[model samples]
Target: MKTAARKTRPAFLDAKRGVGNWAEATEWLRDRGIEDIECITPDLSGVPRGKMMPSSKFTSNTSLALPSAVFRQTISGEYPEETGDFRYDPLDGDLKLVPDLSTLSAVPWESDPTAQVICDIHNTKGEPVVYTPRNVLKRVMQLYTDNGWRPVVAPEIEFYLVAQHEDPDYPLKPPRGRSGRTITGGQSYSIAGVNEFDELVDDIYDFSEKQGLEIDTLIHEEGPAQLEINLRHGDPVELADQVFMFKRTLREAALKHGIYATFMAKPMQDAAGSAMHIHQSVVDARTGKNVFSNPDGTPSEAFFHFIGGMQQLIPKALVMMAPYVNSYRRLAPGMACPVNNAWGYDNRTTAFRIPNSDSAARRVENRLPSSDANPYLALAASLGCGWLGMTNKIAPGEPSYKTVNEGTTIDLPRGLLEAVSLLESEPDFARIFGQEFIHTYAGVKRGEFETFMRVISPWEREFLLLNV
Candidate 1:
């Protein structure tokens, strides 16, 4: 996996620092003639939760508050009665939302000019709410900072564009393209297939530019109407914020065309599932050099250790990667998904892959996280695993030269509850992601799994009504 030397720092990484400060944000809104503002934050499930108000009120009101219980909510929007050993504030305490000015962007789909800004959660005492997903990422980043390392990440998200439907029980189908016909076959990397929705693709590009997001590439995936977008590599936090906002922006853009853009891990029964594959590398904070490569232009000890860390700890952190009952469906034996945490060079079959690149751009691509995962938590968990490897000098197993497919043994948790229990019991994960956060997350996911269990699926009714 050797390649020619290239520039270590790219322009997009430098451009990520745009739109910082209060004056800049105000000017951005004024320039766009923005009237409304959506002050938002990502909950445990990566869903946006916060208040919407007039732009003027948003700038004036720095005291915006949301209930602390927002972090305790499951993907289904239900709260758990018992949160393991962690007790919620009896009063359901209020938390302040402080805007991250860099995230301020225009809501391009709004008929009326509107803006959206991501916020950080803080308690009345002015301390960060540790259990919040954003803060949890920051906690992990701070660990890297302590070690004089800065992690950079690029996320490749895959999702499906399905026909608009209201019924929960109805099966999802591919949305019709500009040709006025539904996509009926897998069209991986087909230029003609991508052109079928040229108008929608144009809107996606237009909306992304308005929001200052950079898309590295776009390709048609193996599923009908399933597309993949690769984001330029940059700071982990900034990339996570972009992914969070991009999901909403994509859905809004899809709705405008009378279709639904779904980030579900497994939307259809037979189609390939969606994934959020993350490519990551760590840089020396003091020196602007990739820590994974040495001066001799070869892989460094840090590179192997990082992979070792991921291999050692990612299984314990599977709950963060595959966060739901449906998420597990995406992690099964086939359809190009990894059933185990095997590593290899240029092998898609392995969960961790060292892509063919020059020393300066050397990185590991973690293909574990589902599209439905909280980007903040997913990046944090992935990076946290690598951090442990580097610090502990953990050695990774030999890379599998042979194809590791469905016939290969599975090394990951098979279900949501199984994944949750592994995360809850791992002390190393609790040390990286806060203890209380782990407890709260486990409780919320456990509750969601229970809720899913009570439901009677169509498959069960069809098979067991008279036969069993």
Candidate 2:
């Protein structure tokens, strides 16, 4: 294969293996009148867990250490006895929090002059924690780098703005618009719907600019009070970082406006599901040219194999794409969400969608992921699936254009238990992600499932309890 001309590596990636310039970062925050620092690292559940430190304590070589057990904790903060091996084996050990300096930015929404940075977890020996979602993604990127390929990804994440609810058991409603009336009607792509929240949109733009997140377009989705925002395409690592930070920023911005923003995959039973649809393309490491297209402007072999590889892995990789029990609810038979791995031209029915575009812009849109999945893990799984095909020259045959066509026989995992069972044992998946990560991630997932099953749902009481 002829390599593309050499392109410069993104600065953020260069620092992934090394610490960011902390000396200048400290002085930069001080110059901006930042007083406090929120140091955060993403846990297995994609939840941020860390401490807030005084700006005075911020140093060039600051080390934030915490127990490794935090990574094994379930979504509800419980540690399953089975998964607790990482919790307290002869007393829980510390993992060092190494901040990625490229992520440092001022927290614009906060009343206090504060800054925040995302960190990656490392063992006491300063080894990358393979189980950490961020580190896992980093390792996956290394696979592409080793092959002299770079992936460009842009994400369109959907979320909802709902009324504040103090109780978990209660259903959330759409918050009132500026007109004081709740946005109950499904106004998909309505400019009027967006105008109702101009203040919020403006605030989001201002906050994002201050935080270094390049947010692109905003749209009113099919669901009531739902907003879908697009991010500009760039390096996969930085794109993942932006998505993670953007989710938090939306919540903080919503709270300031007296509403709650949620990224739950299926927040409402009747509402359309929220998805984190990733648009991806590979570029030659040297030339920075799109690998999906040939010099003559035709579909390249890499493009075909990428789709073939994605189809091969979608069944097992769905767990990473849609990481929760609730996520399955979104993948219905006939809904907009994909339940099969079929690939087609601009088809929304398939998991792999090739949107109609020019040769230079040709890319695959993996629509399997929910808004709830961790960006780092989801992106890694997505790229790895395609990379597998590219390297092996996997051939995905004809595209389906009708219902009940090809790929219908391939039964996708319908629940979290089934997904995890597949993820734990899938050989190719473990190869792309490590065996250690598979074991650790599977343990955490099973713990969450077991805890979830213990709950008696409203449907159970409504049907099973009375009927029985």
Residue 79, candidate 2: how far off, in angstroms? Answer: 0.6
lDDT of each: 0.90, 0.85
Ten residues in sequence with the least summed lDDT for candidate 1: 9-18
Which whole-number lDDT from 0 to 100 does residue 334 have in model 1? 71
**Count of clashing residue pairs in every prediction:** 0, 5
Runs in model 2 deviating more than 4 A are 1-20, 83-89, 403-410
Candidate 1 scores a C-alpha RMSD against the true structure in Å of 7.1
Query: Clash pairs of candidate 1?
Result: none
Note the residue pairs that clash in candidate 2.
4-286, 4-287, 5-286, 5-287, 6-286
lDDT of 2 at 219: 97
Taking the tens digit of each residue's C-alpha lDDT, what string does model 1 give over 1-468? 898889674333333224767766666666667799999999999999999988877766468999888888878888888854756779998999999887877788889998888999999998998989999999999999999999999999999999998999989999888888999656999998899888889999999998889889999999999999999999999999999988997998888888999999999989999999999999999997999999998999999999999998999998998999999888888767998888999999999999999999999999999999999999999999999999999999999888887674688999998998999877888789999889898889888988999899999999999998
Q: Residue 171 of candidate 2: its Cα lDDT?
A: 87
Question: Best-fitting candidate, measured by TM-score?
Answer: 1
- lDDT by residue (tens digit), candidate 2, 1-468: 999999974454322122357666755766667789988988877888998988878764667987988887888998877643323445778898888877888788888998888888988887998888998898889989999999999999999999999987788899999999999757989999998899999999888887888989999999989999999999998899899889988999999999999999998888889999999999999999999999999999999999999988777888888888999888875445778778899777778889999999999999889999999999999999898999889999688786532343435898998998887766887778887788778888888888899998888888998688
Residue 460, candidate 1: C-alpha displacement in angstroms: 1.0
